[model samples]
Target: MLNIPLWKRVVIVGLVALGLLFAMPNAFYSRVEGHNDAVAAIEGGAESPELTAMEGAWPGWLPSSLVNLGLDLRGGAHLLAEVHLEDVYASRIDALWPEVRDALRDQRATVGTIRQQNSAPGELRVRISNPEGIAAAVQAVQALAQPIVSLTGVGERDLAVRSEGADVVVTLSEAEQLATDQRTMQQTLEIIRRRVDEVGTREPTIQRQGNDRVLIQVPGIGSAEELKALIGTTAQLTFHPVVSQTRDGSQDPGGRNVIYPDLEDPELFYILERTPVVTGEELTDAQPSFDQNGLPAVNFRFNVSGARKFGDYTAENIGSPFAIVLDGEVISAPVIRDHIPGGSGIISGNFTVEESTQLAVLLRAGALPAELTFLEERTIGPELGQDSIDAGKIACIVAFAGVLVFMALSYGWFGILANIALILNVGMIFGLLSMIGATLTLPGIAGIVLTIGMAVDANVLIFERIREELKSAKGPARAIELGYERAQSAIVDANITTFLTAVILFVMGSGPVRGFAVTLGLGILTSVFTAIFVTRLMVVIWMERRRPKTIEV
Candidate 1:
């Protein structure tokens, strides 16, 4: 211990200094946050006097990373939503209709004329005029079934077709329904994440709950309703051939026709074909722009397949009207003046610039395959978070004061060295948290306070061992060296077990439990380093300078 190397001492001092430097920004958290935001905005081509002032709030040379605060610490919106997975079943059945119809139409001589009949939810029935051709019609529809590629459904086909008298019945296989639910859940999660990220909310917590629910906690959003508005719209955009314009809902729309109202005028409605010529899924890009009339609009481009279909439809149906529908409301219906061969078009609507921008964002993020019914929603205020911070600060201060006084009273100058190391350990924790962009929460603060009490364990063990060696009439340097060597195993054994517990908690827990685990795990690493290297290095330096005949412990 007395013979510490020159390189080791330099490295120890350098690390401590670096940690304190990284942690300094937290002292002026708001200023550093402003500086970071200003810098990001300026880089993004935004310029203003306010931005310039914020840029100068903190020095550019200093480290600007700050520990992000979790929702419980910063306040935000929380929601628990149950996904309506059954909603996709009906749409899936409707989607299979075109393929089934085309297959049956190809064998028109045998099947005669086939017409879709009203059936139960998630089932499609087709009636063939020639009852003797029921077997042929079922075989034709069954040919459209595709193999499912999932692990649990590897050998199963997605559809099952059967004939009852002159009617051919079609429904999704059980395995296919299971696969669809899984896909819907995954797509919903991904789309919601993208939408939230586009808005740039800090440290949002979005996770699956049970099998059919999602839990969302977004910090910095005003309320749960605001967040719902941002992600709730399905954005299911489609282009359909308009059958007729009418305001009568009670009138029959006829076979395969649906009535939808205009987005701008609720009373004005358009009857349209149930199946769309093209859907938003085929879109590759969408951006907000002004149309030829200098009105707010969204310009969208489609993939190759969509482009071909759109071009063919427009070319064949020139002079007919096609409606652009979004989430069941007709946004616009313009007559095709010419063939739109490039698969790109502008959608003009009754919208403000902000609405157009949001629509573009949603289009780019894709649509939610199923609906979300909110089970719970809450808005946590900043004042409540401020109270949590204040309480945590008081608890930490009290813990630090008690630890500092106890150590100093027990070991004199060596105690003071331990206290300094303890302070640096805390700084290093925050430094590491900032480096990784960790979000600190209330439970995480408790972990830090608990760490403060645990950090002195190794020091106490080493100091007591030194006292024992001193009483045995050993030299000061020899006693210090033997104390650290003897207590090393005990310290290692104790911390290792605690570290394992932290690892297990991190893996098995969620939300607040995870926050606590992260802090505890990081604290263990920093505490062990400060205890073994930092305090030991300080003692060695002091001993080498003083070279005292006697030492007090």
Candidate 2:
């Protein structure tokens, strides 16, 4: 056993205590409203009473803030969405086959015609006019197939392909084809989470489900409809010149007339057709700001390429009004007086602060790859979270008490030392969690409970080994030393295997499951340290001080 200095032990314990002290306010007593109010008061050129109180009441410890509570423990909605791979495949097939037909026509390879037939769930059959260039056509199709997960021959000439699960498939599409698949879905979910977080929603859980699915749980979010609207639509934005038709089919009396294409019904328009000069993708940054006219608007800056494009488009199209379209709706039409060279422009519409902010957020998140469909949604209430916390606390208390009683009854005085180490182990877990700002889910609480039970397994092994050594006529101190030494291998082997499984789970799992795995893994590490090192240290000190002739086991 490596002998740790007493001063080193003091420092470790002192640091743990200090961490707990600093974390208390953020963990249990810090009020969100109070923090906000303090900031607002200070901003308004007034002294904040709350700030003064906070300063006075501040605990003197390193700020190890409380673990972030997860949605499951804090009551939040759980959502599961399956990606419409079928729709994506169909769209890809439709788009690609047309290009294929055009290429074939250009090559003059087709002696007859081309047709598409459905083979399997995600398989496509392309009938060609001539069998002469069929190999070349298949090779051409294979080039496009590179972006897809895997392409295999269904029969003789038919091709069968499907995305490889979720992550791999999404990454392949996003990186290779610029096709939005699983990656798009996952990014959309993350953006939505950021948006909700900006709105001060606490402990929201957003994660990717299977391959094409997303699971989101927003705790304490009352505005489900608004959130759905925010998350479900593709907020594609574009700037187009207003095309006007006069009474003579040339020009209208109005300066410039603009039309918007209806998203649902392409045949209809909110306005007449206008060619787009620029799209939102070129935007580098957007923020809510007041325009020169003192109207709430979204001020945006474009990249160099976008600036050049916008400058060229506007310089040529002077006196023509350009309509800013968002999600297929005309938001504003501003006449170009001078060319915008720097790529900075203001979207001045009649907007409230909230509307302007939301618009800015939408612009920042960029356009969604495809239209989104919300298949499932749920909202968890704070009361549910409170209930979970209550239940978890009860379980933890029961487990801890049960472990304590079992240890004391089984091993007498030495068991008491193990129980003390167990208490420290719990403290160390919380301390580490607070220090790292880990989010605690219901599964995390269960992990702690399980740790409590498993922690004793180490001590139990050591105690059993000591009993065996005593039976072999070993002296008290010698038996104690041999017991810990012999049991070390078994204890390490068991914990290491469990730790490996936890690592795997943490890597592969999502959201709450990952939280559970993280806690379990961390607990195992801390338990090993406290159970073996701490317990051994205590036993050594006790033995040196008391020099007991026999140890009760």
**Against the true structure, whose TM-score is highest?**
1
Candidate 1: C-alpha RMSD after superposition: 1.9
**Candidate 2 lDDT by residue in tens digits, 186-285:** 6667676766666666667777766666776776566456567556656667876666422342323231234454333344444443235677778889
Lowest-scoring 10 consecutive residues by lDDT in candidate 1?
249-258
- Clashing residue pairs for model 1: none
Checking candidate 2 for backbone clashes, the offending pairs are 74-385, 76-380, 77-378, 77-380, 83-212, 166-211, 246-251, 246-252, 259-271, 259-272
Q: Write the per-residue lDDT of candidate 1 for residues 1-553, one digit (tens) a residue.
A: 5688899889999998988888889999999999998998899899999999999999999999999998988999999989998878888887788998999999899999999987887888899999999998998888899999788799999998899899999999999988988888888889999999988788888888888998889988999888998888888899999999998867778667778999999989999998899999999999999988888999999999999999999999999999999999999999999999999998899888999999999999998888889999999999988999999999999999999999999899999999999999999999988888999999999999999999999999999999999999999999999999999899999999999999999899888998999999999999999999999998998887888899998
- Window of ten residues with lowest summed lDDT in model 2: 163-172
Task: Tell me the whole-model lDDT of each prediction, alpha carbons only.
Answer: 0.92, 0.69
RMSD in Å for candidate 2, one decimal?
8.1
